[model samples]
Target: MKFKVDRAPLLRALSHVNGVAEKRNTIPILANVLLEHDGETLRLTATDMEIAVVEEIPSTATRAGAVTIPAAVLFEIVRKLPDGAEIEFNQESAEEPLHLRAGRYATSLNVLPVDDFPAMVAGDLPHHFTIQAGELRTLIDRTRFAMSNEETRYYLNGIYLHVVLEGKKNYLRAVATDGHRLAKVDTEAPLGVKSMPGIIVPRKTVTEVRKLLDNDGADVEVALSETRIQFRIGSILLTSKLVDGTFPEYSRVIPQNNSRILRVSKQDLAAAVGRVAAISQERSRPIKLTVTKNHLTLSAISPDQGIAQEELDENSVSYDSDDVEIGFQARYLTDITDQIDAEAEFALADSSSPTLIRDTEQPAVLYVLMPIRV
Candidate 1:
């Protein structure tokens, strides 16, 4: 097979496809990317069994054929080539090595049998919808931080995406939790999404999809079945298997009657939490929050490091409920607060109950953080 392509376009396609190949693969072909040329365009595909990414770029081919080459090696070679350099690829046969040439630089990569490469068959995706790239990004960014990493409860290792009906309107919601904290965000459901089944999008798939959403105004076409989900972004296509386990009924964990309200500048609370948490040596790095009318104080103590405290009064916080003291893991507090804009509003029931947090500027996003004993 022989083909000629521009360095810039080839590098961009390789960069996207190479990430899907596993660095350590028990199967040899899983470590390589399949390249196919059809005289007019070249297609690059890489997969790690669970997820696959494929991208195509314009190419000029004199001999049409396909071969598999190590993804990392090909990516690095093209990435270092001079900008605007035209690259030529030549392979005598599937058993022979793949040769690459760019200006004065030339190299050959050991090739693998194209027949050994596995394809992720996206069987019969019945549900189809189109969403703005910006909206898809918002759903992922606001909730992915709370996804669980624990393997025991595999269901919680991804964001739960589902459709909900509120009165007359349909909404698409993304919910993620790691037991200690939960993030929930929703957007208006696009047409034809109401019939789609709830799916758990694995963490790795969420990350790869987000990386491709560089242009917010672009449209992303999504198609899904019960077992798999596929995303089409311009010339790139990503397919991933859905988590098989059923997600727990997350609504049960969201607090409903928490009425104590404390509003504070997000920047102030985050800074104070960071300062006091510095004193704790424990993994949780527990920080105590004492809130009263127009006053809030953050404190932390470690047996070896002593204690640290910071206070925010009427100037930075607004509170009018009975005094309450709640404890939270310092990292959890920062993660939730980081999603807030200028102001963060906290709804509390008591020191022992879960506290609800919200970005005052965005009503569609909410967070629930469980309290830890101080």
Candidate 2:
């Protein structure tokens, strides 16, 4: 197998596989990337069993064959080569090592037989649809922060993506939670997903898919099955296994009615929480929020560090509830508030009930944060 490719495009393709190939794997071949030459295009594929990504780049191939090489080493070598240098890869025989040459730099790497590489069988994917990249990105960003990282309830370690109907209008919703907080965001549902089943996209796969949504105008083609999902972006395709555990019915956690309402600037609340949190430690970084008449006071206390308190103008906050005091993890408050741009409406039932936060202008996105005991 022989091919000549430009450094820039080759490096870009190599980067896509770094995360998957460099991950710790028990199988040696799994650390390598399969490269196939079809005389015109070079196909690069990397997989860690759970997820696989393939990208094709233009190249000049003198011989048509395939070989597997260390993806991390190859990427580093190609990245350090002089700019504009053309990379020449040659493997005379299956037994011989793959030879790489770029300007004055040259090296040979052990090659693994392509047949030994694990075969990724993409079973029948019956459901297919397309969504704008920008819209999909928004859905992920709004809810990803709330995904559970704990291993016990593995089902909550991903975002639950499903299609819903609101007032006869179709909508796609992404919901994530970690027992402490929950985030739910909705967007107009794309065509052909009406019959699609709810799927829990793993945290790692969600991150990789998010990287492909950089182009706002591009449309991402999605294919789904019972346990697998595929995303095609330009010349790249990513396939990942869905989480096996069943997701909890998130609807039950959402508060149905919270009579007390408070509206304040999202920026102000975020800043106040951040400042107070500075004195508190990670494990017990709880901030107390006291609301009365038309005023809100934020305070945090730490045994080792000094206390912090900030008072905001009563006139700037609009509240219809009686005086109440609630505690929350300062980091959690900042994370949810960061998703909102303008005014944030806070609905509180009491000091112990979960608080619902929402942006008045974006009714489609809602965040539920459980109160913390201080």
Candidate 3:
């Protein structure tokens, strides 16, 4: 295939695939990207059997043809090229190697027949939804930190995305957990997803799509089927396989009715945990939060560094009991607090129990942090 393209657009498209392509694959063709030139536009496609991406960019075409080239090598070459240089690619005759030229520089790369490249059928994802790009970014940011990293329990390695009705109104809820802590965020369900089944989006896909959401105002076209999902925005298309196992019924984990409550500023709570977490090492990191009446006291005790404490000014807050001390991974507590976008909120339940965190002004999101005993 023969076509010429600008360095910037090609580089941007390849960067997304570079992360998805596994270094070790049974088939070498899986390691390469299929490039098809159809006179006016060039299509770049990559897949690892689980997810696939296809992006089309405007190009100057010579003779129409297609080939498979190592995605990483092509990306690196174009990325390092001097700016504003028009790239010319040609495979004029099957007898010759693929030729690349820009200015006085030239390189030849071995090519494979494009027909051998694997085919990716997107499936019939008839249900398509449109959501604000920035809103999707928020859903991912608030909950992704809690997704399970353990691979053995493959079901928990993704964010659970589904439609929910709270107070008899529709909303989109994202929930993630790693057995230690859990994060759940609720936003108004985008216009078209009210009836779609709840789906688990894999962690890898989440990380990739998050990067694409940079253009906050961009609208995302999302589609879902039984086995695969398609996310489209402008010229970008990301297709990924959904997890096969059933997601644990998360509702059982949420506290039904908890009476204990403590309202504290998110900023202050985050700072307090971060400060005391300095000496927490390994699994025992900064581990204590003691709440009494309107006064909040944070402390951490470590065998190596001993103990430390900090006090916060009191609010009108009152507790259901005398005093409660809860130990948490200083990092986990800090992370949970960072998800809260409110100044004042409550931490429900006792130090020995799972705590529910809520924002007084914004009740849509609920955060749960499992207490770690020191």
Candidate 4:
């Protein structure tokens, strides 16, 4: 195989494909990337069994052939090469090392037989739809933080994506929870998605797909089956296996009739929480919130260190309900507040029940947080 390509495009393609290839692999071929040239364009593919990424770049190929080379090694070499340099790749046979050449640098990489690379067969995908990049980004950014890392409840380790029907309107929803906190966000459902089955998109797949949606104006084509999902972004394609588990009915956990209401500036609340949480030594970093008629106080204490408190009066917060005191993890509070734009609304029942939080600027997103003992 022989081909010539510009450094910038080749480096970009390698970087994307290399992420799917694991550094340490029990099978030798799983650590390598398959490169195929068809005398016009070059195709690069890498897979880790669960997920696969494939990208095609325009190239000038003198011969049509294919080979597999170490993914990490090839990526590093291309990334370090001089920008705008024209790179040449050549190989006489599968048994020979692949030769690479730039302006003043030359090297050869050990090649594995292309036949040894396993192909990830994407079986028939019946459901097809398209989504705007910006909408997809919103759905993922708002909910991924709450995804569970605990392996015991594998169902909560991913974002649950499903279609919700209300009368004649259809909404696409994404929900994630780690038992202590939950995030739910929704957007208008695209056409042809109403009949699709609910699927749990694994955490790793969510992360990789998010990286590809850099251009908000671009449209992403999605096709899926019960077991697998595929995303086509420009010239790149990503296929991943859906998490094999049933997500719990999340609506039962959401609070319905919380009477107390408090509205506060997102920036002010986040800053005060950070200041008080700095003094706490506990792993949970519990912070106490005391809300009275129109005043709010945030405090944290540690037996060995000290106590820190910050107060926000009626000018900074708007509250008219009865006094209430609640404790919550500092990290959880910050995570939910980060998604809010200007103001955050808290609907509370008491210090014992779960508190519902919402972004005042966005009505379709909501969060539920369980209190921690102070």
Candidate 5:
């Protein structure tokens, strides 16, 4: 196998696949990247059984062949080479180690048989659609923070992607929750996904897919089956196995009628909560919000340290309710508010009930936070 690739462009492609390769693998081939050259373009693939990422880059291939090399080692070598250096890869035979040459730097890496690299097979994926990369990124960014990390409830470990109808108008929705807080964001339904099944996209897949959608005007082609999902972004393709579990009926958990309303500046509320929570205990980090007719008081107390209190005025605050005090974990509030760039509306039924929060500017995204005992 022989090919010549530019250092900078090749490095970027390698970086994308490196994260998919398992760092510690009982199967030796899974830790390496599969490199195949067909005399014009070189294809690089890495996988960890659950998720697979493949990227193709233009290269000058003298001999069309394939080999598997240590992903980390190859990426590191390419990254350290001079900016404009051209990297040459040569593997004379299956038994010989792969040789790499760039400028005055040269080294050989042990190669694994390409046949051992697992091949990702996608059965018939009938549901096909296309979405703007920027729009998809926005939906994922708004909801991923609430995805659960608990392995026992594996269903909650990723974002739930599905299509839904809002007052007879169709929309694509992404919902995620960890039993503490929930985030739900929606976008106008894409062209051909009306019949797409609701799939649990594992946390790792969501993260890797987000990296590919950073380009604003790019269009991402999406294909799905009952058990897998595939995303094609430019010359890169990502395939992930869907989590084989049923997500809870999330709509039941969302409160529909919360009468009390509190509106405040996202920046002001976030800053106040951050300052007061400094003195909160490291474990629970509980903070209290006392709401009156026109004022809101944020306070937190740490048994070992001290208590902190701050009052935010009515400059960007408005409410229509009697006196109500609610306790919440400081971290949850900050996480929810960080995603909003404008004012936030908080609707509550009582101190014990779940509070619904939404962005005043973008109403399609909503959050639900369960109150905690302080």
Candidate 6:
């Protein structure tokens, strides 16, 4: 197979697929990328079993053929080539090695038989929908932070995406939690896939799909089946296997009635917690919030280091009953506050309770954090 493609277009497509290709794995074929030229367009594909990314773009095909080359090597060669250099890929047959040529650089890479490259059978996806890339990005950005990394609970390692009803209106909701914190966001669901099957989108797939949505004003076509989901972004397509376990009933963990509400400037609150926690103990990184009528004091103390305290002028900070003392992970508070551009509030019942951090203005997103013992 012989084909010529612009360095920029080829690099962009290869980078996306490179994300799923492993640098080192027990399976030799998993470490390489499959390149196929169908006479007019060249298709590049890479997969790590769980996720696969494919890109098909216009290229000049001299001899129609395919080859498997090291993903990292191809990416690096294209990346280091001179500006505007066109890359030439050639493979005489499956037995011969692939040769790459660009400017003064010429490299030969061993090729693996394309048939050995594991191919994932696309399921019969009955549900097809179109979603604005901008909206999908919001769902990912808001809840991805809460996805668990612990392997014991495999379901928790990915975001739970489903189409459901919020009251009477249909909405697409993304929920993620790591046991200590939870983030949930919802938006109007695209009309066509109202009956779309709910699935656990794996962490790597979530990350890759988010990257594809970065281009402004792009529309992504989504297709879902029982075991996999496909996302078509521009000329690129990604297919990911759905994680197979039931996510915990996270709705039950959210506290509905936390009477004490503490409203504070997002920047001011995040700053106070950040500064104080720098001197707090390492185990807890706990900062105390003392709410009063018109002032909120943030303080943290570490016997080995020192004490840090700061106060924010709260228009009204007193609790429903009296001033309440609550301890929280300073980092968590700062992260939640940073997510909101506007001023926010945290509702709490007492020192030993979950806190609801919410945007003071937006109606769609909610973050919950379980209190940390100091």
lDDT of each residue in 235-347, candidate 1, tens digit only: 99999999998999989989999999999999999999999999988999999999999999999989999999999999999999899999999999999998999999999
Worst 10 residues of 2 by lDDT: 17-26
Instruction: At residue 169, give the lDDT of candidate 5.
Output: 87
Worst-scoring 10-residue span by lDDT in model 6:
313-322
For each candidate, C-alpha RMSD in Å? 1.3, 1.5, 2.3, 1.3, 1.2, 1.9
lDDT of each residue in 1-374, candidate 2, tens digit only: 98899999999889887777745777889999999999999999999888999999999998989999999999999989988999999999999999999888999999888898887777889999999999999999999999999998999999999999889898989999999999999999899899999999999889888876879999999999979999999999999899998889888878889888888888788888889889977675999999887788999999989899998776468876788999999888988999998889999988899999998889999999999887
Model 4 residue pairs with clashes: none
Task: Evaluate all candidate structures by whole-model CA lDDT and list the values in order.
Answer: 0.94, 0.90, 0.82, 0.94, 0.93, 0.85
Angstrom error of the Cα, residue 312, model 1: value is 1.5
For model 5, which pairs clash?
Answer: none
Q: Poorest 10 consecutive residues of model 4 by lDDT?
A: 15-24
Q: After superposition, how far is residue 150 of candidate 2 from its true place, in Å?
A: 1.7
lDDT value, residue 207 of candidate 5? 91
lDDT of 5 by residue, 217-283 (tens): 8999999998999999999999999999999999887999999899999999999999999996687
- Model 6 global lDDT (CA atoms, 0 to 1): 0.85
Q: Candidates' TM-scores? A: 0.97, 0.96, 0.92, 0.97, 0.97, 0.95
Instruction: Give the residue spans of candidate 6 off by over 4 A.
Output: 280-284, 315-321
- How big is the positional error of residue 16 in model 4, measured in Å on the Cα after superposition? 1.7
lDDT of 6 by residue, 191-308 (tens): 8868887788989899999878877588999998878999999999999999899988888988999987877777777777888888965865888888876678888989889888
User: Residue 195: error of model 6 in Å?
Assistant: 1.6
